[model samples]
Target: MLNVFTPNRHANNVLEIKPEELKERNIKGIITDLDNTLVAWDEPDAPEEIIEWFRKMGEAGIEIVIASNNNENRVKLFSEPLDKSFIHSARKPLALAFQKARKGMGLKKEEIIVVGDQLLTDVLGGNLAGYYTVLVTPIVETDGFWTRINRKIENLIKKRLKRKGKI
Candidate 1:
């Protein structure tokens, strides 16, 4: 059960995941959480560094889709300007949205990875959907009310995973 929350890899942020490394692993598609994963949850747009990272991924022929539980308006406002594909109100930890994103990307499960900052949602959802998952440290210290609750639960789970040397 705990294995569902475990990520295949962990990084400090999205930028830490290099395009070359992904290319080597044959990862052709990326389904990522928008809030706190790519940018701070409150941030409205992608910063220059994140733009550069996206450019690099594009150069490597990697397709990316933003899969967020956030509202459609918020997701659209953040993703449209960047010309990125997106699935809003994704309801992570559920298979439907993940499946939709994967199918939209036209990539097989083995060729894609799901990246996000939360274990309860992103990691578990990705793993359950049969894709590789990458857990990134939250970019900001503060989280929204619900996310705060999830974080507390995640900390407990993390402690257990650490005790078993699974993290």
Candidate 2:
């Protein structure tokens, strides 16, 4: 059961995931979480560094889609300026959104990776959908109320995963 929450890879942030590395792994698409994973939850736009990262990914022919549980308005405001595809209010940890992302990307499971900061939502959803998952440390220490609750459960799970050397 714990395996569902385990990510195939972990990184400090999305930028740490290099385009070359993803290319080498044959990962053609990315279904990434917007809040916390890409930027602080309160941030309204992508930072300069994140913009450049997206440019690099595009230069490498990698498609990216924002799959966020956030409201449509929030997701649209953040993603539009970047010209990235997106799915808002994606109730992740459920297979529906993950399947939609895969189908939308027109890529096979192995050709894409799910990247996010949450274990319960992103990692579990990705794994359950049969795609590789990458867990990134949240960009900010602060989180919204619901996320704070999820973080508490994640901490307990992390401790157990650590005890078993699975993290």
Candidate 3:
């Protein structure tokens, strides 16, 4: 049960996940969370560094799909400008959205990585779907009301994982 919340890898931020390392691991596709994972939840656009990171991944022949539980308009607004694929209102930890994104990528299960800032949605969802998971630190300390609740729960889980040396 606790294993579902554990990420295969952790990074301080998305930028710390370099294209070179992914390429080395033969990672061809990424299904990543939109808000907080890529940028602040309330932030409207991608910053320059993030844009460059996307460009670098594209140049490395990696496909990216933005998967968010946020509304379609919000996800569409963010993804279209970057010319990336996306799945909105993902209902994650459910496997369907992750599978849809993987199918769209036309990649094998082992070739994709799932990344986000949350354990409940991202890590558990990715693990349940059998993808390599990367849990990046949330871009901001503050979260929306619901996320704050999730974070409190995550803290308890983290403590247990820490005690077991599984984090």
Candidate 4:
């Protein structure tokens, strides 16, 4: 199942993607991870580039919701518009959060894209929830004890996926 890890498809942290590309692909919403996928975990505020990207994506009519393992405080502080709802205290690698995020967007599984940096949590959870998954590179390498363990496991999956030529 970890064959879902696609390293080459990871977008730049600056969001090099054009909104039109996602629109043409029929993706109505994006469920993104908070820590590394959206911003550097240690960074206290969202960068100007990220703010612009979110604004552009919103202007293009795409719904974006954050599905983060971080606590509600962190997620709320991160996505300050308070306009879009998010799944905080999310226990990833579980389908519940993905389900909640998709339901929050009022979008079908097929119309949503789950973007994150981890294979086990992000890709696997997104796939299990029946949404398209986009695995991105970590925004910053340093992590907590638990996250370090998860990253190790994700690295193993990534190597196996590469051997299988799935990435």
- Name the candidate, 2 or 4, with the larger lDDT value: 2
lDDT of 3 by residue, 1-167 (tens): 79999999999999998899989999999999988999899998999999999999999999999999889998999889999999999998789999999999999989999999999999999999999999999999999787899899999999998898887
Q: What is candidate 2's local distance difference test score?
A: 0.94
Error of 2 at 115 (Å): 0.3
Model 4: per-residue Cα lDDT over 1-167, one tens digit each: 55445533566553966689889988889888888887888776777888888889999998998888988888888887646678898898788998888888888887888888888788777777777778777889987567898988877877788788787
Candidate 1: regions farther than 4 A off? none
TM-score of 1: 0.98
- Residue pairs in clash, model 1: none
**Residue 148, candidate 3: C-alpha displacement in angstroms:** 1.8
Global CA lDDT computed for model 3: 0.93
Task: Tell me the TM-score of each prediction against the true structure.
Answer: 0.98, 0.98, 0.97, 0.91
Q: What ranges in model 3 sit over 4 Å off?
A: none
Tens-digit lDDT string for candidate 2 (1-167): 88998999999999999999999999999999999999999999999999999999999999999999999999999999999999999999898888888899899999999999999899999999998999999999999888999999999999999998998
Worst 10 residues of 4 by lDDT: 1-10
Query: What do the candidate models score in CA lDDT, each in turn?
Result: 0.94, 0.94, 0.93, 0.79
Cα error, candidate 2, residue 60 (Å): 0.6
